[model samples]
Target chain A: MNDQPAASGTPASGGVRIAVDAMGGDHGPAEIVPGALDHAGAHPEDQVLLIGLEAAIRAAAGTLPPNATIVPASQVIEMHEHPALALREKRDASILVASDLVRRGEADALITAGHTGAAMAAAILRIGRLPGVDRPALAVQMIRTGAPFVLLDIGANPDSTAENLAQYARMGAIFAERVLGIPEPRVALLSIGEEKGKGDLRIQRATELLDASGLRFVGNVEGKDVTGDLADVVVTDAVTGNVVLKFFEGLSTFIFDLFRDEFRRSLRGRLAYLLLRPGIARIRDVFDYEKAGGSPLLGVRGAVIITHGRAKRRMIAFGLGVAAETARTGVPALIEEALREDAARLDAAGAGAEGRAEETTLDPEDTP
Target chain B: MNDQPAASGTPASGGVRIAVDAMGGDHGPAEIVPGALDHAGAHPEDQVLLIGLEAAIRAAAGTLPPNATIVPASQVIEMHEHPALALREKRDASILVASDLVRRGEADALITAGHTGAAMAAAILRIGRLPGVDRPALAVQMIRTGAPFVLLDIGANPDSTAENLAQYARMGAIFAERVLGIPEPRVALLSIGEEKGKGDLRIQRATELLDASGLRFVGNVEGKDVTGDLADVVVTDAVTGNVVLKFFEGLSTFIFDLFRDEFRRSLRGRLAYLLLRPGIARIRDVFDYEKAGGSPLLGVRGAVIITHGRAKRRMIAFGLGVAAETARTGVPALIEEALREDAARLDAAGAGAEGRAEETTLDPEDTP
Candidate 1:
C-alpha cells in the first residue's frame, strides 16, 4: 500500500492527526492504548484519534492528552475473520470507525494492527480508491534495508490478473517515489527466475504490460532479490508476496533456532551469547519490524495503514509514527499525477492501435 | 522414492563396479577426480566403481587407487542444459554411464552433480524404480536446528496429487528413521497455517490421509515450522520446495545485505563488523550449505545423489560424504518397510471388500 509525504498536493496542516484502532491487535486495548499514549507523549505535536469502546479505551489509556480523545466504535473485527465478510457485517467496527474519521476529514490517516483484509475492505468501502487507482495493495516496508522495498498486494489479491499486476507496478512506483522518496525507483515483477520465460502465464502477460506501462519496469526479479535492495519496488501479487514474506520470517526464525541450538552446545557457548548480547541485539534490529511499524494500503484516496494483528504495544506506536510521517508528506497528490500520466499513456496507445489496425490488415495464418 | 532398511534383502556383491562421473561440477574433475580417488581408496570399506574420460581423470587425480579405473563416456551433462531432454538423447552422457554402471551390475550406487533432473532420469531409465514404487522422490536435509529436518520432493514432483503427497509422506518418514536414526520420525504436511482448512486442496487432502496413515503424523504446520525441529520429516511438492528453497536463499542474502548496509552506515559501524567477526562468522555459518549437500533420489532401485551443479570442492566432498553415509546405513531398507506397510493395508482392505460387495461401499474420498 501507499504512504506519501503527507501532502499529495492537498491543503497543508502542520499538526498530523491519526485515528488508531486501539481495541484491535493481540494485546487489544492494553497495547493499543499504551501505543497511542506513547506516541502522543513522545510526539505532542501530533493528535491521535483513539477509536474503540469508550470505556475500554479510557480504562487502558488512563489519562489521555488533550490532543487525544475516544471515538466510540461499537463493533470489533477478530483477526481470524474473513476480510470481506467482516467488513460487510461489522458496521461500527474500530477499523471502520478509524477509516471513517480519515474519510470525514476529522483525521489525516488511520492505523490498525487488526485484520489486514478487513482494514483494506474498510478503507476501500469508506475512503475509496484514489481517482486513478484500480486496485488497492499492501506495500510493506523491508526494514532489513534502511531504504524501503514495497512488496505490493502482500495479502490483498491472492490470485493476481495480468492487468491488475500491471496496475500494481505503476501504483507501487508512485508509492516508492512519493512516500519512500526514491527517484526513478527500480520496479521489478517477482517471478520464479530472472529468465524471460521462467514464470506462469500471468507473469508472462504482466512482463509485457508492465514494460509498456512506462513505469520504470526492471524486468523480472526472483524472491531473493526482494530483500537485497536490488530494487526499490519489488512488485508481485499479494499471494506471492505473502508466501515470500512468510518464508523470510521463517528463515529468520530458523536462524534464531540455530543460534539457540549452538548456544546450548555447551556452557562455554552460552557464555558467548552473554558477551555478544549487544552485537546480537544490533543484528536483531536489522530485521525488526518495530522500527517501521505497518504496511500502508496504497491506491486508496486517503491514508490507511495496516499492521499485523499480532502486534504488541511497541508495534502500535511504530504504526502511529508511520501514519504521522505519511500524513506529513501528501502522498495522495503524487499518486494522482502518476495516475493521470498512466491514463494519458493508455489513451495514446489506444489511438496508435486503431491507426495500426487500419493500415496493417492481414489474414491470421499469413500474419506470423 | 523408496529408502527402507532392508532387514534381510539381497546384498550387492559379485564384483560390482561403478564408474564415477569424474569430470563434472563447478570444480570439474579437479574435485570429482579426487573424490573418486578417495572413494576408490576406501573400496574395501565401501564398494563402488569409478568411470570418466580417461585422460582428464588421470591428469586430475594423479594415478587413482586400484579399486577405481577409468571407463570412457563420450560426453557430459552440462548444468545449463534441460535434463529430461538431454538424458533422452545423450546415450554416452557421463551421468547416464554412472547409472549404466548400476544397470550392468558394475555399481550399486550412482552419484553426480550435473543436472538433478538428468541424473534422476538417467537413473530411473537405467536402474529403474523398485518393483512397487509408483513414483520417485528426492529427499534432502534442511539444516535448521542441530538436528537436520528431512524434506522430500524438493523439486521432484512439484505438481503432485493428494495420493502423491501421501506416498511422499510415507517415503520421507522411512528415509528419516532409517538413515537419520530417528524412530518413527514425526511427519507433517507443510501449509500456510495450522488450521484444518488453512492450505490448498492438495495439502488438505494430504493432511487427512497422513492423519489416517498410522504414521507419526504431527498435525498441520505453518511455513516457519518446516525449518524448525517441529517435524522430523516435512512433505511437499517439488515446485513448492524449489520456490521455498530459493526464497530461503533470498532471505539469507537479504539478511547479509542488511548486515552490509548496517556496517556501511558509518566508520564506527564498519569497525563493529571487524569487532564482531566471530559472531558474524557464526551468523554466516547459519546460512552455509557446506553442511547440507546433495538431495538423494529415493525410491529408485539404486541410491542416486544429486548435488548442486554449482558445487565447489568442499560441497562436492560433502555430497560424497552424504552418499557414503546413505550407503553405509542402507537407507533404502526403510523405504521398503513403508511401502510394504502401505501395500499390506491396501491388500487387507481390498480382500475384505471382495466378499461383501453389496454390504461394502467403495469410498471415493481419500481424506477426511
Candidate 2:
C-alpha cells in the first residue's frame, strides 16, 4: 500500500491514481488504453484510470490489469474543434473528466496527448492554478548536448510579461530541482545575445527582477548556448520558446531525412550506413522527444503531462511514468511552497509584494 | 571593359568596387587580405579595395593583385567595443571606412566579417538608408534541406514593429527573387503557429497588412516549416530571427559533435565513419554558414553584406562574392523603386501614405 497522502482526497487503493484521457490524441483509446494498462501491470503501486467511451477502452484493451479501472467519459473533443467551445458543449469529454478527477482528488495526475489548447484550458479551468501563480508553463527537456536542460513557457503564454517570465523561471527551477535532481538549478533568460543588456526591453527588465529574486539567476543566455551545458533552466516568452521548440522538432526530422537520402546515394554510403546504424540510432535516441515523454504543465494544482499528439503506446507509457513520478514527488505542492517563500522574501525586501501577489492571484472560475 | 555602372560614381575600371573590412572579425587582416586578393584575381571584372591598417594588409597579403587596392585605415574596431560609441570615437575604423567608401560611391558595395553590431551601425550611420525605409534588416540564407530560403531581420532591430516586419518581408522577397533566383518569392511571417491569428498582436496585425500588401503572401508559417521550402522568404522580429539563426548554428555543431563522439565509440563505428566521411561532408557542405558567405543588410541605401565574425579566408572570399553580386544587381536601388511604387499604391488606396512615408524617411545624419 502507499503511505503518500493525496493533495485533497483519499485514493481508492492507497496508491497513486493517474487519470488518462483515453479518448484524446490521434489514435485515441486504441493506443492510450493499452499503454495505461501496461503501466498499471508494471507498477502495481499506481492505479490507472482509463477515462473514455467505456466500449472503446474495453475493445482497445481486451483484458485490463487489476490495478486499471475504466472511468467512462461520454464525449471526445475532436482535434480541430475550438477548445473553449468544445469544453463548454462537451461536459463529459475525456480530457474534462480526467481533469475533473484530479480536481476532485480522485486522481493525482492527468496525462493527455490530445489537443494542447484543450489540455491547458482544462488544467486551468478545472485543476486550477497554484496560489500566486499567474499562469502555468509548459516545460520541456532538451537533451541535445547529452545533458538534459529545461526550457519553459514553450507554448503556454505567447504574450508573457516580465512578471510571468520571472514566475516561470521560479517554477522551472523547482521542476529542475525536484524532478531533474539538480540542487538549486541555475536559471537563465533566453535572449538574442549572452550579455544581460543585449535583449529587448522586456528581457532587460526581467534580468533585473531575476537578479533581485532569490533563485540562482545565471544572467542571459543566447539560442546557441541553450543546447550547451550553460544553465539548467532556460526561460523565454512563449512565442520565442514555442518557435524554438518547433524548430528543434523540425530539425530532427530534417537531419534524419538528409542522412537517409545521403545513405541511399551510393553503394558505399549504404554499406557505411549499415555499419553505423547503431551509432545513428544512439544519436537519435539522445535527441528523441518521445523518449523525454511529455512536457509538464507546471504551476497547476495537479501533475499534468502533455504528450505529443502523435504519441503512440511507448510514448504514452513513458508519459505515465513521468506522471506517476511527478505526482509522488508532489511537484505542484513544492511549487506552491516555493512561490509562497518567494512572496515572503519580496515582502521582507519591501518591494510591494502584497499588491503584486494579489494581482496575479487567480480564481478557478476566471479561466475558460 | 565593363558595362554595369556604379550606383552614383564611375568605377575605376567600369567594374564593381567592393570595400572589404580587412582589420575586422576574429582573424582580422590575416584571413581577410588573402581572401580579397583571391577574389580579385578570380573576378577580373570586379575591384577589391582592402580597407585596414596599410602595414597589416601588406603583411597579410605579402603582395596584392592588380585588381585589388589597399585603402589604409588608421583605427580598428575591436569586437567587444560598443558599436555606436566605437563608430563615433574611431572614425577611421576599418568597418567605418568601408561604409564611407560605399556612401561616397568610391565602392559599389561594403562587406565586413566584423562585429555584427558595428557592421549594422556603420551601414546605418555611414552608408545611410534607402528612401522611405524605416530600418535596414539582415537577411541570411538557410539551406538545410538543400533548397535555400531567406530568413530576415536576423539581428538588425530587436524591437521590430509590425511595419518593420512588413518592410523586412518586402526586402527579403526582393533578395530571394533577384539573388536566390526565386520567381515571385513566397513570403511568410514566422510565428508560433501557422494560422494568421496564431501569433502575438504584432504578428496578427502584420498578417493583415501583408495580406493587403500585394506580394505573394503565404499567410503565416511556423518555425517547423521554415527549413522545408514552404516559403522563399520568412520575416520575423530580430529577436526571434536571431534566436532561430543561432539555434541553427548551434544545432549543426551539436549534431556533428554527436556524430563524432558516436563514431569514436567503437571500432565498427570508427570504420563506418571513415567510409561515410564523404556523405557526411556533403551534408555538412549544404548547411555550412561559411558557404552561405554573408547576410545582406537590406534597406540600406548602399549594398552592405555582414559576414560571420569567425570568417576565415574562404568565408571572406565568399562574402566578397555576395557583395559584388548584390551590388551588380543593384538590389538597394530596386528596393527604393519598389517602395516608391508601394507608397503610390497605398496613396491610391487612401491609407495615409504621405504621413507614413514621411515618418519613415531617415536623414543620413539622423543615424548613430
Candidate 3:
C-alpha cells in the first residue's frame, strides 16, 4: 500500500527520509500523524513516511504536507502482546512496515513510539545488525544533569558478556563524539563502586577490558556518578541499565509529586509554588524524556529510534528529528567501522579471559 | 580494655547496652562521641559504651555522662583497607571491640559509621550469623517519596543465589513488620520488569521461590516502583541494590544542584527560590539518608547498624536509636525462627531448579 507520489520533494541533493510508525504508540495516529506532519513541514527537503492505516493517518493528519506520505499498514500490534509472536502473526504490522522501509532503502531511518520489545525485534529481525556486533544496544542520552551523557544497552541484551559491554563502550563513545559533539568522550562501565575490583563477576571483567581497550576509559562509575559530569558514555548490561533508567524516570515523577504535596499543604506553600512554578517547569523540562528525543537502537544497520509509548505529538516530532539527524550523520556506518578496527583487540581480550580470571577474586563486601 | 565503670547504672530494669565505634566514620570520635552522648542523655536508663583510642575519645568527649562509659580500643581501620586483612591485623580495632562486646552480651547492639566492609566483617567474624542464614544482607530504608520502603543486600553479597534472595525477602519482610511497623509487608524482587520472568536468571528463579514462601509476595517490582508505595520490602543481589541506592542518593544531590542553578539563572528565579526555600528544605529532609538512621545488617546474630562513613552527630544518634530499637525487637532471633520454619519449602525450591530451567527463555529485548 505505497499509494503515494513518493518523489515529490524538489531537493537538489542530500535529504533524509524517515519512516514513522503512525499506529504504534498509546495515542496512535492521533498524536503521531501531527508530529510527522510537523517534522515534514519543518524539513521540506526531507520526506516523512507515515506508516499505518490510511484512513486513520488522514483523519489524524487532516491535510499532510508535500514532503510527507501515508504508507498504509493494515494491522496494529498491542502493547502487551509477545513481540516475536505478534510480529509473526501480524505480518503487515506498522512497526514491521516501518522497519522494512528502512531495510529496503526506501527510508533513511525509522522512528517508533511503539511497544519497545516489538520495536527492538523488528529492528533486529527486519533491519538487521552491523557485522561483528553480537547485539544492538539501545543508547539513551540523559540531560538530567545539564551536561548530557549517553547510557547504553538500556533494555537490550539482558545477558550481555564482558565483550558486549566493551563493544557498547565503543559504540556509545562514537555516538557521544559524532552526534553529541563531545570530544574524546570519557567512557565508563556502570558498576556498584568506583574501584576496579568492584561489582559483579561480569562487571569486574568488563572493567579490565575497558581499561585495555584504549578508549577514554574512566574505569568504573557508580549509579551516583552517572548523573554527574564524570562520564560522557556509561555502559552496562541491559538489566542494570534498564533499572537505573527507570529509577531516574520514576524518581523524577515522584519528586514532582512530593513538590505538589508540599505546595498544597499550606497557604504559604501555595503562594511559594505560584512564584516557583516557572522554575519547576524548567526542572520538568530538564528531566522530561521527551526532550531527549527518544533512544537510538544502536548497532543496527539502519537508524531506528524508539520513544516512550506515552509520547505526545511534540515528543514524536522530536524523535523524528533525532532519527533524521542520526541518519544524516551516518552513525551506524561509523559504528561498523569502529567495531571493525577494534575487532582484533577485542578478540585477544576474549581469548585472555581465562588468564585474567585467575588475577581477580570475587570477594563479597560492603562498598560504603 | 573494659575500664572500671561498666555496670555503674544502679536500677535493675530493662535497658539496651549499645557499643559505639567512635573511630569508625570520617569524623571519628569528633562526630560520633557527641551523638552517642546525646543518645545516652536522651535515654538515661540505656548505656552507651564508647569504644575507640582512649585519648581521642576523651578529647572528643571532655566529660562523659553517667550512662556513657569509655571502652578503650587501640586501633582504627582506615576506609580503604581490605576488611579481612585489617581485621586480622587490627584485632583491637574499635569496630572489632564493638562487635566483641555485642557477642559477649556486654552490649545488646552495635553501631558504626566506619568502613562498611570492616563493620560487616567484624559482625560476621565476631558476632556470627543466625542459624540457616547463608549471608548477612544490609537493608536500607528509603523515605524519598514519604513512604518508607526497604531495599536489601545493598552491598553485602554481590553474587547472590536464588536462595539468598529468597532469604533476603524473608528477612526484609520481618524487619518491615517488626521495626518499620508495616504489617504483613509486601515483598517484591527488584527486577527489570514487573512480570514473573522479567529479570536475570537468579531473579526469575527468586520470583518463583518468593511466590511459594508464604509471604505477601507481590511478584516483581521494577526500580521505578521502588520509590513508590508498591512494595514494602524489595530484595535483590548487592550489585543492583548498591547501584540503585547510590543512584538515589547521588541523584537527590544532583537535583538540589539543579534547583540551585535554576535559582541563580535569573532575578525572578532568585526571588522565587527565597519564597520556596522552606519547601525545598522539606524535600531535602525527605531524601536525607541520615533521617532513616543506618542500614541494618540483617541475618546476623546481633543487631548491627551500619551508617555512612560521613555520619555526623545527629546521624550517629539516629543510628544508635535504630540499633536500640532493633535489639529491643529481637529481629535476628525472629529472622532465625522464620527461616527455620520455611527451610523445607526453600530446600524444595532449590532442588526444583533443573526442572524450572527449561520453563523460561532468556530473550534480549527492550522493556519499555
Candidate 4:
C-alpha cells in the first residue's frame, strides 16, 4: 500500500499524508469524501488519501480538492460489527487498508470514522506498539478542559491489573504533556468517591500502585469530574470509562431533545429558545465530541485518531488538526521513551511482573 | 419518650405517640417548628410530641397548636459534625431525644432532618430493627419512568452483599406495591448495561440473587430507564445510587441555572421564559425532593423517616405529609411481617449467620 514497497522505512522528503476510511461512518463516502477535501483544501501543503471503492468515493465527492484523492477498497467494518473478527477476516477492509498506508510509509498517519475498537485494532495489527509499552490507551483532548484528560483503554482493556492501571497513568500523563502541552499534568483515578476505601477492590489496589507511580496522582474522582476538568488526566479500566462516556453522550442527547421539543411548542417558546440560546449553546459546546475529535490509540509508534461512527465533515477536519498536532509534537516517541524508562525501573524494583508486554495476547488490532 | 410504649409484637397500636425533632435542618425551628405544628394541627386526635430546646421551640412556634407542646432539650446535631459520634455523645440532641422517646414510652415513631448517619444510628440503637430484617434500607420514592419508583437502600448500607441487595429488592417491591398502590410492582436491578454481565461485580451478583427472590423482577435497566417509568422498584447498592442521586441533583441544577441565567439576560429572554415557564416549572416540580419529602428507613420495627438536612418549610411540610401517609398506610406492620417471614426462611435455609441487624454495629446510648 506504500507509494514504493521497496521504500517502506524511507523518510519522506516533504509533505504529509493521512489515510481516512472513506466507506465507514453513518454518512459513509458522502461525508468522508467532503471532509477530507475540506481538510486538505484548508491545508494545501498536506495530502489525505481517501481509501474506499473508487466509484463510491467519486460519486460522493461533488467537487474535489486537488490534494484529496481516492484509493480503492471494497469492504467496511460497520459500527455494530464485531471489531476483532472483522479486522482479522477482512484485511482489505477500508479501515485496515487505510491503517496499512500509515504502517507501510505511504502516509504519515491514519484517521477513521469506523468502529473505534476496529480502528484501534487495525492500527495495532498494522503499525504495532512502541517497544516496552504494555498496552496502548485511547486518549482525547477535552476541549472543555482545554487540557487533555487521557482516558486510557476506554474500551480496550475493560479488565485490568494494578500494574496496567499504573502504566496507563504513566502513558496518559506523557500524552498530555507532550501532545496537549500541559506541564506535569495532574493524574486522577476515576472511582465512586474521593475516599481511599470508597471503590471496589480493583480501584483500591490500583490507587496504591498509581500513588507510587512517578507522576503526580490526584486519587479518585467521580463521573461528573470526567467532563468537569478537575484533573488533567483521568485513568480507569476500559469498562468504567465506556459506561461514563456513553452515559454522557446519551445524557447530552436527552437534554437537547427535551429542549428542542420545548422550543418548538409555540412562538413564545421559540423566543425563549432564541433568548436562552447562548447559554444553552455554551452547555452544548462544553459536551461536544466533534470538536474533541476521536480517541487516539496511544502507545502505538504512529498517530492514529479514531472518530465516531457518525463522523461528519467537521469531525473529520478536527481529526486532521489532532493528527497534525500529535505528529508535530512526537507524542508516540515520547510515550515509548517513557515506557522504556518505566519498564527499567519496574525490573530494578523487582515488581510483581516483568516482560509483561509479551503476555498480552490481545493486540490493539484484535479489538471487538 | 412516647405516652405509651409500642407492644413488642406484630401489630403496633395506633395510640402510640411519636416525638418530632423540632430543631433540625438548615431552615431549623421555622421548618421543623411549622411541620410539627402542622402535624398537630392536622391530626387533632393523634398523639405526637415535639422535642428541642424550650425557648427555641416555643419561639419557633409563633402560634402554638392546641394539642402540641414543646419538651425542652439543650443539644442540637449540626449537619457538618460527625454523625455516629455526635449521635452517641450528644444524649440530649433532638435526634437522640426523639429516638429515646420511642425507646421509652413517649413515642412510637421518630422523624428528623438531622444528619442521616446520626439519625440512622440513633434509630438502630433506640428502636432497633424488626425480627427478620437484617439490613435496614432507606426506601426513596423516586419519580422516574412517570411512576413512583421505590429506590431502596438508596443511602443506607453503603457497602452491601448480594443477599442484602436481594432483601432491599424485596422490601422495595413491597413498599411500591403495598404503599405506592402499584399492583405487582415490577422490580429492576439497576446496572450499566442490560446484558447480564455488563455491570460491577456487586450488581452482577445481585442480579442473580434477585432473580431467586419472590418479587416481580424486571431484569436490568440502564440510567436512562431510571427516568422512563419502566420499573416500580429499582434496587442498587447505596453508594452507586447516592452518586446517581447526587448526579441527577447537580444536572437538574445546572440545567435550571443555565436557563434562569439566560432568562435574566434581557427583555426578550424574560418574555421567552414566561412563555415556556409552565413547562419548565412542571419539570422542576416533578423533580423537587421537597415534594417527595423524606424517604422512610424501611425494615425497622417502626417508621423513622429521614428528611434532608437542607429541609426548608416545603420539605418539612412534605415530611409531615409522608408521616401522615405512612401512619395511615401501615408500612410499619408490613415491614414487621416481612422481617418475620425472612427470618423463618433464613433459618430453614440453614444460613446460620448472625442476623443482619446484629452485624450492623449500633451505638450505645452513651457511646457512638
Best candidate, lDDT:
3
* Best-to-worst ranking by DockQ: 3, 2, 1, 4
lDDT of 2 at A248: 81
What TM-score does model 3 achieve against the real structure? 0.91
Q: B1-368, model 3: which lDDT tens digit per residue?
A: 12222121111246788899999678999999999998999998789999999999999998888899999999999999988789888888899888878877788888999998888888876777777888889999977555688999898877789889999999999889888888999998888778876877777778777777899999888878878788999898887888899998788777777778877888877776777778888887787778777999998777889998898999999999988878777787788888988976657657545526322222434211
Q: How far is candidate 4 from the true structure (C-alpha RMSD, Å)?
A: 9.9
lDDT of 4 by residue, A211-293 (tens): 65678888877654555667888777654555445544544455566667778877867877877777677766655778766
TM-score for each predicted model, relative to the true structure: 0.76, 0.91, 0.91, 0.78
Error of 1 at A184 (Å): 2.8
Of the pair 3 and 4, which is ahead by DockQ?
A: 3
lDDT for each residue of candidate 2 in A187-244, tens digit (9 for 90 to 100): 9999888877567767776887788888899898887877888899999987788889
Model 2: CAPRI class: acceptable
lDDT of 3: 0.82
- Candidate 2 lDDT at A83 equals 74
Q: Rate the local accuracy (lDDT) of all candidates.
A: 0.68, 0.81, 0.82, 0.68
Give lDDT tens digits, candidate 2, residues B1-368.
Answer: 11223352221334688999898788999998888887898998898999989999999988777888899899988989877678778877888888878877788888888888877877776667787788788999887665688998888877788888888989988888877788999999998777665767777777777887889999888878877878999998888888999988787678878888878999888888888889889887777778778999998867788988888999888888888777777788888888888888877889853222111111112211
lDDT tens digits, residue span A29-142, model 3: 999889888888888889999999999999998877889899999999999998878988899999999988877778888899889988888887777777778878999998
In the range B1-368, model 1's lDDT, one tens digit per residue, is 23322221224333333445675677778777776566556554555455567778778878656666677887887877766667656778888778766665565566687766577777666666665666678888876746787777765643466678888888878668766778989888776566543455556667766776898988766666666678988887654555566677777776666556656666555665565556667867766776665788887765677887777656666666566555555555556656878778868767443221111111112111
Pairs that collide, model 3: B24-B114
- DockQ for each candidate? 0.14, 0.27, 0.39, 0.12
C-alpha positional error of residue B207 in candidate 3 after TM-score superposition, expressed in Å: 0.4
Q: Which ten residues in a row are the worst by lDDT in model 4 chain B?
A: B359-368
For model 1, what is the C-alpha lDDT against the true structure? 0.68
How many clashes would you count in candidate 3? 1
